[model samples]
Every structure is written in structure tokens, then in C-alpha cells.
Target: MAGAGLKGARERRVRTGGIELCVAELGDADRPTVLLVHGYPDSKEVWSEVAVRLAEEFHVVLYDVRGHGRSTAPAPLRGGFTLEKLTDDFLAVADAVSPDRPVHLVGHDWGSVQSWEFVTVPRTEGRIASFTSLSGPSLDHFGHWIKSRMARPTPRRIGQLLGQGAKSWYVYLLQTPVLPELAWRGPLGKRWPKLLERVEKVPAGDYPTPSLPQDAATGAWLYRDNVRARLSRPRPDAFAHVPVQLITPTGDAFLSERLYDDLGTWVPELTRRTLPAKHWVPRTRPDQLSAWIGDFVRTHEEPATRAPRPVAEAAVRSGVRPEYAERFGGQLVLVTGAASGIGRATAFAFAEAGARVVAVDRDAEGAARTAEMARLIGAPEAWGEAVDVSDEQAMEKLAATVAAEYGIVDVLVNNAGIGLTGSFLETTSEEWKRVLDVNLWGVIHGCRIFGAQMAARGQGGHIVNTASAAAFQPSRALPAYNTSKAAVLMLSECLRAELAGRSIGVSAICPGIVNTNITATTRFAGVSDTAEEKRRQRKASRLYGLRNYPPEKVADAILGAVLHDRAVVPVTPEARGVHALSRLAPGALRALARWQPPA
Candidate 1:
């Protein structure tokens, strides 16, 4: 309890600047050293989940800043928590732990604030090998950011300044004299963990140890001692001397992504990473943070690893959005119905973002070909699985095999479905059941099986269900198809609501019509002769071809839906128009649905 789940860790103390800093070490010391620094209102235990993970490959070190956790508080708390003093504590810890080797530095929030000081200043230049900053900006850089905006004062700059000012309301609060201390030592501290659980979606656990109250109370000095002084008279020469990896949580409540727009000027060797998470990502997203940190450390530690492989360069050369690469890199993505058309295109899109892809379809050869091409496109790893999504036992087996071999799926795209064009009375019971089985039940099976795994993992994920514009816009000729798609749309909405608390996003993709093989294979119900069904299929395919809305566009929409966590997405102009009509003029849609198409 005291260490808050930092098992098998060896602890020691290093004296610096009139205080003893509590340092905890894990893994082999002879390996590369990775030193982790904690943020405001937290302790070394804040890095417990991440430290243990990185320790598998490197010597991981975590320490309490003075006056936090088990570390002795400064005699005079007012003047003690300065960046200057914090830098000294860092050097002392580095020297005590890895005296001969430079340590890779990682910091979150206030820890990142101080670590920026440790990396930029001349005194600790050679001691730090690399710096990874999360959720915190160098106060010096922030100061410069403010001055540039004030000097230009353009409309956009003014808006950005106002937006950031609003987010910093809490910073203004912390500058208050005794209220912060009183609130922390009183009710606020008691409710902080629950507050994080509700607001940040940080999982409940043994964190924010009992020392939190005192830590929060004294941590107020972190802002007080440094903010005003550094912002007003920021060092002109404050530039990072080490390779820097800045991991920005796009949804951070405090910092704006715009804060780092000009960061390239200050950090010469910079790698930017973004995640769709909140401010407290160290706890909420430790797995991702650890993976990024370890990868960065390894690349920096061994120069041979820094050279870009052909696969690593392919995404850039192929012109995928950099944000997608940053957000989805190394994530596991599973796409159902991936043998051809929209499903294949969607799989390739995610593959281009560096996701490990699992392409599932009934056609084993087609699925394997999709997987092979996906790896060539940019995916680090990919595999093909043959299974009919309508089969529940097969899906269960697929899920189990994927978990055992590949890992928990981070994104599941239920893009598999069938085409059935027939009026309700014309469609036979067998035909209706077959359409619903694949078009509706396939999505149901994938969601029920894979979604459970995501929720149970508790790390959060995305689920995309490929519904259709027929879901909202009814047509007599497409009764069975519309019924099945409508069910999927409603199911996605319901799942989205239920999974909101778990951080899982569910999206229903509704494309009006696209050129895909489904059209050529659609069943024209009530048709007795095989020749008649073939003619109908040819006519439908020709009509779709004349419209010429490519499946690639629908694939792009699916990626965007997952990226933005949209509830319902209409891809093409026709789909958008129908969606609007369904909402605004339902009777108009009904009239249109009643009109028969040319035979």
C-alpha cells in the first residue's frame, strides 16, 4: 500500500539541496536507465504501472520530488519548489542511480514542467540522454508562445489566446494564496480519486497514496515559485539539448494542442505523438505510454535502431495523415468482411496508419491476399482469418485465437454484410432469415464477442458497424435490407450509450450506395428462375456503376468516424441528403421510397 503496487522495487534516498529524494529502481541496473518523474498531487507510485512495464527492458527509476510522497519536505516550502532546485534534485538522483550513464527522462504534468528544466539548462546537459514530455510544456516555451500572440494579435491568434486563457482558469486558482492549500488538505483531497475516475476515466486503483493531501498542499508551490517569474522573464536560450518526444493528449482539459505548434523551433530533434485521452494519461493510458517510451529509449540507446526501415517510411511516402500514424500506431485493429470492396479498403486504410490488422472473411484466399497487401502498405503486422461472421461459435473461436496470439483488439470494424433487394411480402421466410443472419446477426456476433473482450480489458477501444442509408431511408424494394441495416444502426446507438463509461466508442456507418461486389451478388427475392435473378443483379450493378461512388470513399469515412468517435456517419452526398431528408422531411422520404425503380 505504501508503494502503491510498485512490486519488486528497490528503494533508496539521495540527498540534494537540503532534502532526501526517495528513489525507486526496477529491472537490471546494467541496462539503459529510464528515469520517470511524477506530476503535481502525485508521487513515484503514479508511474507504478508504466515503470514496471518499461523495466522489462531497461533500468527504470522513479523518484518523489521534495515534499511529496516519502521524500522529506523542504524546511521552507515557499522558496523550495523552484525549477532551479528541482533540476538539482534530478541530477543528484541521476548521479546516485546511474552515475556513469546518461538517463532517459520521462515526465508528466508538473514533472514534465521540471524535466523540461532538467533537459534544457546547460548544467545537466550531458546527464540526460533523451526527454519525453507528457501533458506539460516548458514554462519558457509557454512564455514565448504568449508573447508572439500578443505581438501579432491577429483574429486567429486572439481566439487561440482566449481559448488557452479559459483552460488555464485552474492555474489562476492555484496562484491564490491559502485556498489551494486548505482545499487540498481538506475536502478536495478526499474526493480527488473519485473526481479522476468520473472526469478523466482513470480506472479505480491503488493510486494517489495517503500522502496525497500533503503532496497536493505542498505541490502548489510548484506553480507559485516558477510560473510568474518564468513567464515574465523567460530564458531566451531555453532550447532542448536532447532528443525530445512530446506526447500530447488531444483532449487534455488544461493544455491546448496549439501550445506546441511552434515547438519545432525549440526542439531540434523532436518526435511528436498524440493520443485521444485526457490530462492524466500516465494512469489512464499507461500501456500506450510505456510502449512509446520504451520504443523511443531503444531507438535512442542504439543508434542502429534509429535508421528508418522501408516499412516505417512507407506510411509517410504513401501520404497517410500524420495524426493517424501518431494516434493509431502499434494498435491492433480487426476488420470483418475484409475480403473485398469496402471492407478491404477499410483494412488498408487502417494498415496505412501502422495498425496491426486482422482481416476476416469467408474467402480464405481473399482474406490472405488482403492481409499480405496490408503489410506491404504499412502495417507492422497483419494476419488473415477465414470465418463466416454469421457463425457464433466460429466468431468465439476467432476472438479466443486473436486474444491468445495477436492481443486484445483496440479497434473492431464490423463491416461485413449481405445484400437483399425484395419487398416485405415478396421476400420468403428463408430469404429474410438469411439476409438478417449475415447483415444483422454478423454485426451482433462481432460486437458481442469482441466488444466484451475490450470492456473486460478495460483499456477502451472503438467499434464501427457498417450500416447503410437504407437504415434511415426506407424503400419498398429493399425492405429486408433496410430492416437489417436499421437494426444495426439502433444497436450501435445503444452500444455507444452503454459503453460510454468504459471509454469505448461505437459508430454506425451509413453509405447510400457504393460500387461493391454486394450489388452483383444481391438476392432478388421471389424470383423463381436463376436467369431472372442474374438479369436483376446485372441491372443493379450497372445502375451502381453509373453512380460510381467508390468504396474507397466509404472506407475513408469509416476511419474518420473511428477517429472522431462519430455516432452515425453518412459517407456520400446521396447518403448525406437522405439522412437529412429522413430527419427533416420524413414524408418526402416515404414518397421517394414508394416510387419504383426501372426494371
Candidate 2:
């Protein structure tokens, strides 16, 4: 109940259809207005988390539908609460709030339902500038969708209909006359909050106002008045006149993703975004919601100011697929060791996908360059931070600054590491410590600090730790490196298991040997002659160059691993072969480890 109230909000009342709506405004009225609509059993306060965040950039507005919150209900709830009345309430609020300028409309659940009506219908055309919809579809669109599916009746189409029908169980229940109202006014009202927290993971805030019981009771009329009528005979000319941003929560309990598969047919300009969240996204994923909503609204409002960059060439150069853009666009991604090689390629890839990139590395100049190129590629924003991942305090400070400046990170890559090559007996304690500090401890610091931030946010995230194939396939020439990488592999596996419940995925990437500058600077222990060590370094570099495995492929593997939740991805043919051989025949790997390379 803590976040159940709005802060510093100026409140007003707008009367439209015999009932008055309670409206709250935040931020400067001069800015583009972002009007938020709430769903069934919820007031505008359901958007408390998101509205406060959006207020930083836009004029944020939230209103209680006539029957909910501080708003006055109709003389009789039965005949009120239809989409038509809802549209009237929306327009009244819009005119009262912004009058001259069109408002950017954002809706969740029931709010989204009525908003769909607002954007598509003829009357509300010029009033709404843009619409960002999540967890709700237009009733008219829904009607056509069902009719199309029923008419076709293929096995796949039938499955989709059934899947959607099962998800609409609550919608059906809401249509019952006095039963839903009775339930809401009684025990169901008392248990609803905890049920939402447990099932939807909606953060407890100034939401689900005390008017919940009555709101839920009267809210039943929304479905009772609309669903059957609209579904049976949806309006034919229901095409959207404005740009539509559809945000789908993949895990929504009340809606099926398949419902919007053919949404492109109705809207000329459409942008699609998907969230790995439940039904109540505004409460559960506010940071993500605010960022996306702000971006979408800004792009449409100031097209001249936010002009397109030359990303077509960058996209081709980076080899980024369109599918990745759908998933990572607008997400904040942080990568350590992002200055060069695999890390640089990975940063560029995410940038091409339209992510905000934070490039961190010990080489400050390199990191800055990477960030600059990331922005050029397609990242809306990019920054460079200099830090040694081995330094725990530095890493902690970096995490704090990133969170304060960039919002919560949606993806984190622990790719910083140092290479040490030597037999276990010949390797000095100092050399072993150096390798362990940068390789093993660096990953520990990153995972602990950033992973904690991701967990505390309660929104899901992904972590990628760069390991090596030497972890599974033993190597006599690389004892310290193998040990450190082995620990990282095991750590990644353990973290994956523990963080699964929190919806954080951990992936360990193991590349056998790719052409990277790490080999040029690799330490060769037990060789006292500096010239001989340099010669060995050159030889190793040459061997890797001959192998010619590009880091871009490894970067691709890293992205794919995160996308698919793959545990251990061994990149390069040799890495894959060694990984398989180790699993099938351990003795062969051990025998191979004993054959030492010439000094």
C-alpha cells in the first residue's frame, strides 16, 4: 500500500457524461502531455510508478474513470462504463489538461481497452497524438481476429483461438450479472492485492486505492457492456488514424500474444515491443515502461529534432539482424572489456539492435571510442567508463553511477579478463594471483554488484560471463588461465540456478581460440628470456591468426546464448569439438593436456 498514492500531483475534476472524473497532473503543462489510463479494479494510481518516471520528460496525466478512484459514479452502474462513455471521459480530461496540443496516450489493460476505442474511432482522431498499448487490444480488432480464425479453422488457427479463449476466462466471468459485483464487494476484494503481488509481481505502491471494492464491482460493467456486442459485430472502419506502439507482455495471463499477430493490417505506422512480464506491467516494469514510453512519445512529437542517423551502413557492417532489434531496442546494456575484440563486437551488435550501451574497460580511450561508434551504429545513447574489473570498489562505484545515470541495466556482460600461460608447477604465486584477480574475481565483482542491481529491480535481466574452452578442455600450456576460467564456468552455472527464480539468466561463453590481441600480450611463465617470451607470444598470435575465428561470431554466440538462455556456448569449431570430447571422453582431454608445448 506504500506506493498507492501519487506525489506532488495537482488534482482537478472534469465532468463529461453526467459523472465527474478525478484527474492528476504532473510536470510542466507546456511539454507534450502523456495521458495514462488505468484498467479494471485499478485507479490512475496504478500508474504511480510509471507516471512519476515519465514526468521527468513530459507532462504526465492520470485520471480515475468516472466510477473509480475519487471520481463520481453514475446514477446506476449497469448502464454506464461503456467504451463510449470512457471515450468521453478521456476527451474531457484531454481538453481540460492540454486543450491546444494533442496528448500521447498510454494504456494498460482496461485503460488500454478504452484507449484502443479512442485511437481508432472517428471522433477522437486529432486529439490523440500517439498510442502505446500494452496488455490490451481493440475490441473491434479482437472481433475481426476471432471471425478470421473461426472462418479459417486450421489446426494452428484453432489452437490459437482455444489458447486465447482459455486466457479470457476472467473476461467471461466479468460478464456475469450480480455475481462479479457481489464477489468484488465481498471476500474477493480483500484478497485481490496479495493475489496481484504473488501472481503479477506488481510492486506494492500507492495503487489499488481504497475504492478497489466499488471499482471492481462497477468495473464489471466494462465487459458486460462491451465484450459480447463488440466481438459479435465489431466496427468495420476501425483502422487507427495515428501511429500505434504495441507493447506486448509475453507472460500476460489475460491475453494471448497471438491475438495481435495480424495487427499490421489495421495500422499504417506500427512499432512493436515485447516485455517479459505478467499482466500488470506498469507496476512490475516501470523503468522499462517509462523509458520505452518516453522514447516513443519523443520520436513522434519531435521528428525533426530526433532525426535518423546513418545506421543502414552500420547495420550491414555489424551484421545485425532485424529480429535482435525487436528484442533489445531501448534496453540498457553494459559490457566490460568493451574496448576491443569480442567485447567491442558485442557492444556494436547490441547498439545496432538500438540498445543504450555502456562501454567499460581499463583502456579509457578504447572504451570511449567503442561508445562513440556504438552511438554511430544505432544506440540511442552510449557512454564510456574506465575501470579495472579486478578492483571491487571501482566496480561497485561504476554500478552505482550507471544506475543513477542510465536506469537499471537490462543486460550485463562480464567479459574482462587477463591471460596467463604456464604449467601449474612453474607458475609463481604472484602470476596466479594476477590471473585470478582479473579473470575469476573480476567476474565475481561484476556478477555480485550488477546482478544485485538487476535482482533488486525485480524486473528480469540477463548476465553473460566470458569463459574459455580451456575450462573444459584441459591445457598444459595454460594452467592459471584454465583454472580461473574453470572457476568462472562453475560460478556462472551456480548463479544461473540461484537467479532462475528472480528471472535473471546467466550464460557462460567459451571460445577455444579466436584472433584477438590477448594472445599478443599473453604472459609466458618459466621462460626467463624476454626475447623468447616475445617469440612465443608471436607464435601464439600467428597460430590464432591461422585459425582465423573472428570475434564477431563469438559476439553473435553471446547474443544468441542470452536470447535462448543457453547455459554453455562453445564458440569456434575447436571449442565445440573440445567441449563434446570432454563430455564424452575425459581421458582423451587429460592425455592431450599432458603433451606440453615446446619452450
Per-candidate TM-scores read 0.81, 0.90
Q: lDDT of model 1 at residue 167?
A: 94
Cα lDDT, model 1, residue 63: 94
- Residues 336-392 of candidate 2 have per-residue lDDT tens digits of 999988899999888877788999999999999999988888777899999999999
Candidate 1 per-residue lDDT over residues 1-599, each given as its tens digit: 23777988999989998899889999999888999999998999989989988887889999998999999989788889899999989999999999988999999999999999998999997898899999999999999999999999999999999999999998899999999999999999999999988777777889878899989999999999999999998889999999999999877989999999999999999988877678988887776687678767866885533434445445443598876777776678899999998999999888888777999999999999999988888776689999999999999999999988777788999998889887789999999999899999999999999999888765678999999998998898889999999999999999999999878999999998799989888888888889999998999888899999988899888888888889999988988999999899999999989988766
Model 2 stretches astray by more than 4 angstroms: 1-5, 302-320, 391-405, 529-532, 542-548, 584-591
Cα RMSD, model 2: 3.2
The candidate that wins on TM-score is 2
Cα lDDT of all candidates, in order? 0.89, 0.87
Candidate 1 achieves a global lDDT of 0.89
